[model samples]
Target chain A: MNEYKILFTGTMGAGKTTAIGSVSEAAPIVTDVANTDLSLGKERTTVGLDFGLLTLASGDRIRLFGTPGQQRFDFLWKILAKSAIGLIILVDNSRSDPLADLVVYLDGFAEDLSVLPCAIGIGRLDTHPVPTLEDYIDILANRNQLVPIMSVDVRRREDVVLLIDTLLAQLEANTFGA
Target chain B: MTILRFGIPHLSDPEVRLVKAFFRLYSQDPTFRWTIVEGPPYDVLLVDESVSEDVVAGTVLTLTPVKSELPNTLERPLRSDHLEAWLKKAEYDLRNARLQPQPPEEQPIDEQRIDPTSSSHFKLRRWPPPALLGSNPVRVRMATLISRRALRLDEMAAITEQPLAECAAVVNLLRGAGLIEIQDLPDKPMTMGRAGGRFADQSVKQSFVSGVRNKLGL
Candidate 1:
């Protein structure tokens, strides 16, 4: 069977593991551990990448990979993003500087993003809606990349699926003639 | 000699070949300078009901709803007359939209010279933080579609199934909030010759985009 990959990256506590587990047929494999970074305020964090799996109707397989959200793990982002078909960048609006967090990933995966079809999912907009979606668009506009974005609670299986589907819609749109 | 590009998707290889043949054989109208592009950034796309959701701020020549005889519907069988008419219509509508009068009260805010109707593949710079336009179905649909791609004024109305005025309001709302952005650079007038495999297959990339969608029951 054929295999493909999609990478999910975001700040700590932004729910990459939850997003994957919500959609994965089996429990997601996580490298989460007791929080070493106290600034993050979370009890645990993924020290390594998180992994999940899904099987397509054709018997092909899609690998769901999530990068370690801390900025120190930036090197692995490029490595994990390689060979992946697309990227999903999640943002935690509740963070002190969500927009800056988004910029880090946008710049971190800048090379991969140029060629990969990507989507953005904003988490916790319900309680933290300061930097409206429009603010994020402005930053993206400055960079000249038109990425599909929305507010999502990755805990909901449908929400995670929608983020993936949004990326696919863009792919489908481009493949109109192929 | 300015060339306008048009994308005609969902057609089979034979049909594309026939369209190219038709373009070569028929060039009586010098005013119509259109080339066939496969993917996007075309001045217009001839769409059926299929890829309606994928549209972003660009003009599209679509068919009328089942026998309704819409003014600019690119009628079926891909006749030369229909093709010519639609291409002409696409150009004319774009010109017409640009010519739309600016409200006297609103100052001209040029965010890279907003054209509103250019068939460029528009992508959002960011998503809206909240729906200030309220939660009406039409407004919700407008937000969803616009967030995906920039819409031609008519496409905003057509795809959302709302009045043109309402769609414009949604765009204006987003524009007011600084949520809009033109994904492709504004068009520039350029010359081109129509000969020797002139119609270019630039792209169309969603290979199995629907795979995950199907598996997820979307």
Candidate 2:
């Protein structure tokens, strides 16, 4: 069976770990530590990588890896992203500036994003409705990047799967030059 | 009752009568008071495609797109449902703006007595004030859950199938907005053993599968 490596990256409190855990067949392996960053307002935070596995109906294995959210661990992001078939960038809309947050991920994965199929999952949009989905589309359009973007609650397995399906669909579309 | 003044500029007599007829239907409604005005100081201006630019210098809801996405423009061939929806959104937005925080000294203080020895100075509010609408779905779901019963962030995440981080963000936003009353959980010890934990895991997996099936229509 073929194996596909997928990377999920986002801001510190964007729910990458929960999203991975929600869809993985087995209990996800999480390496979290006591959060010293009080500014993040969370008691515990992912310090290392989170790993999960899902087997598709076609007998393909999908390895899900989540990078630690802090920009300080960006080195690990590249390390984890290596050989990954697709990227899922989660954006927390409730942040001070969500569009700017999206730009950070876009810039961080600049090389991989150019070739690899990528999807953006925006969370908390119901509350932070100012920078609408159209706003994100406009930003991507301005940057000359075309990708599928959707509102997602990562804790839902279906939503997480939808992101993966969207990425795969994009890859399929690109393969056929549709 | 809030009075919303409207100006329909440069329309024929029959068209003006049609607009007035639309307003008359909602005239009996207690919450919305609409007044058809001739000139300035109108709250909203509904202009036809041929209406000149210098008609009024205020909020304009045009029949067609004028220049670069006018905020309140309604497309041609207005529908009652669409008009009602737009007015509701306008009213909601106005209420939200009014509910925004004023200067500290000018802010109204809650009259509820506070316990000085409490760990946190803020008291948990039960019902979200009506002013707290149009928030993110996560926050709205969390509010609904909280309204039903007190819950922790994790519990809220599980119930709503939202990410823990997203749930935490929503909780923080609600707390910061003073729209939620946090109920402290009683300190309890873990009693579930390994076998129980395994069963709980299976249950969670089963529920997740069912949820996915339902969401995907599989």
Q: Please name the candidate that would achieve the greatest lDDT relative to the true structure.
A: 1
How accurately is candidate 2 docked according to DockQ?
A: 0.02
Interface RMSD after interface superposition, model 2: 18.5
Instruction: Please tell me which predicted candidate would have the highest TM-score against the true structure.
Output: 1
User: Candidate 2, B137: how far from true, in Å?
Assistant: 20
Model 2 per-residue lDDT at B121:
17
Give each model's clash number. Answer: 18, 7
- TM-score for all predictions? 0.55, 0.48
How far in Å is the alpha carbon of B116 misplaced in model 1?
16
The segments of candidate 1 whose C-alpha lies over 4 angstroms from its true place after superposition are B1-207
lDDT of each: 0.67, 0.63
Total colliding residue pairs, candidate 2? 7
